[model samples]
Target: MSYFGGQPTNPFGAPTPKPPILKRQVPPLPENLDMATLADIRCSVNIFSPATGEIIEVVVGVEKRKFHVHDQILRSGSAFFKTALSKEWKEGKTRVVLLPDDAASLVDRYVQWLYTGKVGVTLDNGKTDYATLAGLYCLGEKLMHDAFQDRIVDALVSGTREPNNNAGHPTTCSFPMKDVVDDIYKGTPKGSPARRFMVDMHVMQGTSGWIDVERPESVNHEFAVDLAFAMMQERAVTGETKTKHAELNRGIPCSYHKHGKDGVCGGKA
Candidate 1:
C-alpha cells in the first residue's frame, strides 16, 4: 500500500509540484508630495504706483488712487502676482507691488476682474471703448495670463453687436476707436491674439482703411506693417470671391434682417 488504499505498488515515488504563487506589485510613494495645504491661506496686498515713491502707498495713475487687495485672490488670478509674490521675492515680503505703467482706472478694473471675474464694458452707438479693452489686454499680456486676455476679447466681441431694435432690425456693428487699436498694437507682440483680434475687427467691419487713417500720428510704422500683413493673411484665408447677396424666397421675416411683417422672424422655411 503506497500511502493509499488499493493503490499500485510504487516502483519509484515522485514529488508533486505546486503552482507558483503571485504577489501584487505596489507602487512606492514619493518622498516629497505636494499638497494643497495653502488653499485656505489668506493674505492682503498693497498696490502702488511708482510716482508715490512708497511701496505701501498703493498709488495708481496720475490721480494717485490706492487699492488694498487680497493677495490670495490676486495671486490665483495673475501669473504676474504668482511669481511676484513668491517666497523669495521682496514683493512677497512686503506684500506690496508698484504698477508704474498701469492707470488707476485700469488697475481698478483688473482688481475687479480678480475678485468677480467681470470687467466693465460699455457699448454705445455701435461703438465700443477699445481703450479700456486695450488697457486690460495689455495688463493680461504682461501678467502672462492667457485666460485674462481671452476674457477681454470675449467682452469686446460680444459688446460689438448692438441689441435688437424694437422693430427687430439687426443693428450696425461697433466701431473701435483709433486710440484703442493703437494701444493694442503697440503693447502686444507680433501674432498676439489681441493684435489679430483688432485686425479681424477692422476687416470684418469692411474698414481696413480705418487702420491707416485713424490717429495716424500715434500709429507706429511696425504696427502699420503688421496690420497690413494680418489683413492680407485674413483675406487670403477667408477668400473674397463672393459678393453680398439678398434672399427673396425665404418664408421667415425679422426686423434684424428687415424681413418679417412685424420686423421679427417666424423661423419658417
Candidate 2:
C-alpha cells in the first residue's frame, strides 16, 4: 500500500552503504563498555631468517642487521604472504619468512606502509627520491604488492610533473640520474609501466636526441635499447619524429642536480 502520495517506501529493505573504517576512533569510546568486534587489537608474528631468528635482514657491504615485525600487518596487504604463510608451508608453521636479498630500510618502509598505508620516503628535493621510488617499485613488483606499486608510480609521475619542474614548456620535465635509471631498468621487467612511462617522458620532453648525444655514457645499454624500441613504436604508430633542433638548455639543472640546493648539481659544481 502507498504511504503518502501513492508511492510505497522500502527504507527497511533498501541496502545502505557502509561507511569507510576510520584509521583512528575520535573522542575514544568508553572503556567500561566494549564491543568484541570494535576494539583495537594486536597480533604479533615472527618474520625471521630460519637460522638467525631475525625478522628482516639488511646487508650493507659486509655488515648485516635484523628486524622484528608483526604478522597481521604483513599479511593484510601482501599477496606474497598468502602462500608463504599458508598452513602447508614451513614459513606458516614457524611464522617466519626469509628475505636476505632485500634492503632492510626498504623492507622496513614496506612493513610500515602495510600497517599505515603511508611510505616514509623523503622527497625534500626529489633527487634521491626517484631512486628510492624505483627501488620501492621493484620491491613492490617482487612482493606482488599492486597497491604499493601504483603508489610509487604516482609519486614518480607527480614529482616529475611538478609545476616548476617543467623547465620551460609544460610538456617537458626532468629525468632521473644515470644510476637511478640503470637501477630501474635493471630491476624492472621489460614493458613495465614505470619503465615505459620513463621512456615516454624522455621522448615527450623532446629529449630523444638528448639521450643519443648528451652524456650518452650515463645511459644504460639495456635501457637505451628499450628506449629505442619504445621510440620506434611511438614513431610507427603516430608518425611523430624526434625534434632535430631541440635546444640543450644548460640553464636548468640535470636530473642529478635539480634536487640539490638552489636546483644546482648536488655532486659537482
Candidate 3:
C-alpha cells in the first residue's frame, strides 16, 4: 500500500529522491591566534577611543555650562550629533555644539550614558528620580538617540518595581507625580512611550483616594482623556473591576518600550 490510499501503482516506476540538506559552514579559526590580540581587536571595535578622537565642547543650558565630550562618542550614539558634526554644518567646523534650552544636569547625564551605558536616577532618599528620568527621555528624543530613550524607559520600569521607602511608612512604589507627567506630556507627542507608561501606571496602581488626595489636580485634561480611554480598553479586556497591580506588573517589559517596531525593545539586546 502506498502512503496515500489507492496510489500504490507508481511505486515500481522510480523511487522519489529526497532533497539534499545543506549545512552552513563557519570559517575555521586561525591556527596561532593570540587571545590578547583578539580581545584587543574586539575592544577597539566596540569602545570609543577618547584619546585618539577629537574633543568637542557641548555648551548646555542658559548658563552655557561647558561639557567636553569626545566627538566620536557623540556621533556614534546620537543622530543629532552625527548630523551636526558632519562637514556641512557650522558645528562641525567649530566642534562646539550648543544646547541652550536643555538643562545642564540632563546633558551631563547624557554624556555619562554615552561613556558608561548607564543612567543614574536614584535620589539620596532611596526614591527613584522620575523627574530626572523624564527629562532625560525628552533630551534623548531631542537628540534622536533611540537607544538612550529606551534605556530611560528601562530605568523607569525598574524604578517602579522596587519597593520605595517613604519615611517610615509602608513600602510602596509610587508612580511619577503631576509635575513629571506635565513635563513628559509637554515634551513628547501623543503615543509616546513615556505617556503610555504613565497611563499604564496610573490605571494599574492608582486608587480613587490616591488621585483625589495624593495627586489632586495633577492629572491634566489630555492625560485624563488618555487615561479614560486606556481604562475603558483595559476594562473591556479584563472586566470592570480594576486589574491588580501584581497582574499589571507581571506584564511584559516590551509593552512599555519605545522602539519603532512592535515586540522589539531597543537598547540592550
Per-prediction count of colliding residue pairs?
A: 14, 1, 0
**Best prediction by TM-score:** 3
Ranking by lDDT: 3, 1, 2
What lDDT tens digits, residue by residue, belong to model 3 across residues 86-166? 989999999999999999888876765554344447776767888988898899789877667777887778777777667
**Model 1 agreement with the true structure over 1-269: per-residue lDDT tens digits:** 00000111111222212223334422221122112211211211211110111223245666666676655445544667668877798887887777776787777666555443444465353345567788888977787666667777777776566543533555645556577777887778888877777767666675645655656766667666766786777764222332211232233224246564554454643
Could you tell me the lDDT of residue 163 within candidate 3? Answer: 74
Q: Is candidate 1 or candidate 3 better by TM-score?
A: 3
Score each candidate by Cα lDDT. 0.55, 0.54, 0.67
Q: How much is the lDDT of residue 107 in candidate 3?
A: 84
| TM-scores for every predicted model | 0.58, 0.58, 0.66
**Tens-digit per-residue lDDT, 79-184, candidate 2:** 7765677779887777767777778667755654443344434455533277777888888777766666777777777666554442556554555656667778
